[model samples]
Target: MKIAFPYMGTSHIAFKMLIRDLGHEPMVPPKLSKKTLTYGTQHSPEFACLPFKILLGSYLEAIEQGAELIITSGGSGPCRAGYYGVLHQKILQDLGYDTKIIVMESPYRNPFDFLGKIKSVISCSGVSWWTFIKVFYKAWEKLKLLDETEFLSHQIRPFECLRGETTKVFKECLNVIDESQTTEQIREARKLTQELLNNISQDHTRKVLKIGIIGEIYVVLEPFANHDLEVTLGEMGVLTHRSIYLSDWTRESTGYESKKNIIKAASPYINELFGGHGIYSVGHTVLYSQKGFDGVVQLAPFTCIPEIVAKTILAKVSNDFAIPVLTVFLDEQTGKAGLQTRLEAFVDLLGQKRAIQEGVVT
Candidate 1:
């Protein structure tokens, strides 16, 4: 079977490896573009969130390219994401595409169903259980490495002496990581990636602005969805730490990371986990403030309930903590120019605020 999955940061590279190792052809969707979003928005509900539209658009493209099966994650919360699988299936069926969909529900919700879904998908490939486990483990490790490399790039980009140098090395390292197959190959690639990034000329004395990115996972991770916010901020000499990454979310979903700890951080503002990552958004904002970040940015898909809730509370978090917070609502209609302008203004605000704090300017 030719399996396909939507893009979510660097996860597609890891998913491609896993599908191929399981003896299936991986039909990786092309990078998101305007046409992709168009197809998704045209077919999606008027009020659907940005991520759904983007994923649907990617799925349509993959199906057109003859993808036999599609895999996507599912949720069990009050968020509309819980119905994404069923809705997608309905939409695809209505569109006359018979491609099968496999929704990987969170193991934290139902361990048996999660395992059963994995077994069913791999069973079609006829790979032994041991081989499946090995392949999955390797893929997981690669995912962690990919996220780690990208994290390093975010930290180094703002400090690079030459404009675009960090981004250049980061793209090259992604290709290196993707080409790596064996465990030793992955290890070698990681070392090379670190050396290349660490070697980038940086001005340590530069007064860099620090920003924490918090919001829906999709926009936080997908450059296309968020109009490359991280890259934009980095080029402006801002150091950003995103609240969520593919690997971190995976660990939390698979029960390796404690949700209690994540929730504990948000308990002061939000005692319960609302649908989506509302709690996480709040908690990470608080954490960022505690860490002495200059400011925080929240990216929420329009009409996202959980984020709306978090946005409401974030205003209070900002006032009480004395940390600046900016929330940008994203939809198909969001434009790069406007977003850039808003970001520039926000950065200016943070810079002046920092100046006031340090007595650099009265």
Candidate 2:
């Protein structure tokens, strides 16, 4: 099938690889733009989260580009993301588009659910269910590894100050991996990219404020949605770390139950305070705090319930643990200037907090 997938930050890179590996022509929608967001917001229900609206724009664009199938994921939760694919399908249909919508639902609930969907999308004659499972697992491993590496590179990018060299290398690495290349080749590419990044002149003497960004995946990873906050923060001499990369979500899918059990065993207080997915965010926040990060920044798209819950718990965690926290809520109207101003103020506050902690301020 000539399939298309919407851009959801870095995950789109991995999705492109998965689509190629499955022998489908994957059309990636152009990067998020004003027109894209406007189109999405106009078509989607007002109450839908920002990521859904932005993604809808992507699908609308892709369908116009001769795509026969629209590929998206399914979630199961109180979160609206679970229903996004269905909602987008209905919306597109109402708009007179007749593209096939392929939603890869979570198999954790019913393996048959996913298998049936895949069968409907791709007609494979007499292919055993086990064969499909093996292929899916292998694709998932590649996706998770690529996602984790990209996330790590993002965390390291802002501190490098290499005038976009880090960003360039990161983009090149994605393109290299998407070419159906060997795993060993991809590893070598990553090593060369890292070496190039390390060769850049970075100031180690500067006392940069360390900040952690935690929130919904799309908003945290999409440069357009967040107005390139990481770059802006880096330029302001603030070292930033983010939670909610693709690998993190993939791990949650594979071992969420066990991980949750362990977290509950280790930190019952956290589990009780932040129920459901928020517990994972809380656990990560606590880990970041213990690592001596100067502050924490909680980011969320407007009306994201999971992140809202996580934000509240993180506020308490920050207060109790003596870490400064800044919560930024993003919506269609979120302005770049406003975001930069808030980030600057947050960085300044962190610097003051650090100075006081180190007795640099008397």
Candidate 3:
């Protein structure tokens, strides 16, 4: 089958490798761009969230490129992600596209169901268990390395002595990482990435603001979807930390229930789950406050109930903890100019608050 899937950050790279290992021709979607959003918004319901639209756009494009099957990660929760596959399939049918949708949905309630799905996807003839393990781990390791590179880049970009140098190196590094074809190449890419980033001269003596980014996983991870928020924050001299990484999410999918620590940390603020990553968002906000972060920013797709709930509750967390919170909703129509202006204002507000606390200016 000519299989395809929507890009969710760098996870597409890993999934592409996985599909090839599973004996399918992987049709990776084009990178999210204005054109992708345009196609998505044209067909998507006006009220649907940005991800739904963007992914719809991606699927359509992939089908046009000869992808006959779609593979998407799914969730079973209060969030609509659990139903996206079926709904998206129906939408495609209504639109006259007969592409098959193969959802790798997470059945959180049943381990056997989840395993069965995994087994079904990975069960390819003429592939030995060793070969399967080798390919899978290679892809998985690349995912973690990609996350690390991004995490480190976000940390150093704000303090780099040269403007734009850090981002330049990071982008170049990603390209090299993408070109990596073997485990050895991947390892070398990791090393080269770090060396390049470390060479970006940094002035650590400068007082740089630290901000935590917590939000719906899609918008938080997909920089284009959020208007390159981390890059913008870095350019504004603020170090940014993402609350979740694809590797972290994948680890949980391995049956480890990886969010236990974040859940425990966030227990005081949010005791229960609302599906999606709502609990993680809440817990991450509190954790950020405790870590002396200057502020927190939450990015969500328009009409995402989980993040909307998290945004509402963050008000109390903000007041009780004295940390400012910025909530942003991203869509095809989100204006960059307005978003930049608000970001500037939020940074200024955080700067002023920091000044008062540290007696820099009274």
TM-score of each: 0.98, 0.88, 0.94
In model 1, the runs with Cα more than 4 Å from the true position are none
- The most accurate candidate by lDDT is 1
Clashes of 2: 0
**lDDT score at residue 139, model 3, on the 0-100 scale:** 91
lDDT of each: 0.91, 0.72, 0.86
lDDT of 1 by residue, 195-286 (tens): 99999999989999999999988888999989989989999999999989888888988878876765777888888879899988888878
Off by over 4 Å in 3: 115-125
User: Model 3: per-residue lDDT, tens digit, 125-241?
Assistant: 456667777888999888988999989999998998888888899889888888887899999999999998988899999898999999998888887799989999898899999
Q: Write the per-residue lDDT of candidate 2 for residues 1-362, one digit (tens) a residue.
A: 67898776666766665566566777888777888888899998989888888889888888878898887877766677877888888998899989978787667878888778877654533445565566566566557656755665655665675666666766766666565344565566566655655665665766778778777777887877777777777667777787666666666775553455436532734545333255666676777778899887777888888888878777778777788778888999756888878888888888888888899997
Candidate 1 vs candidate 2: which has greater lDDT? 1
Error of 2 at 301 (Å): 1.2
Rank the candidate models, highest TM-score first. 1, 3, 2
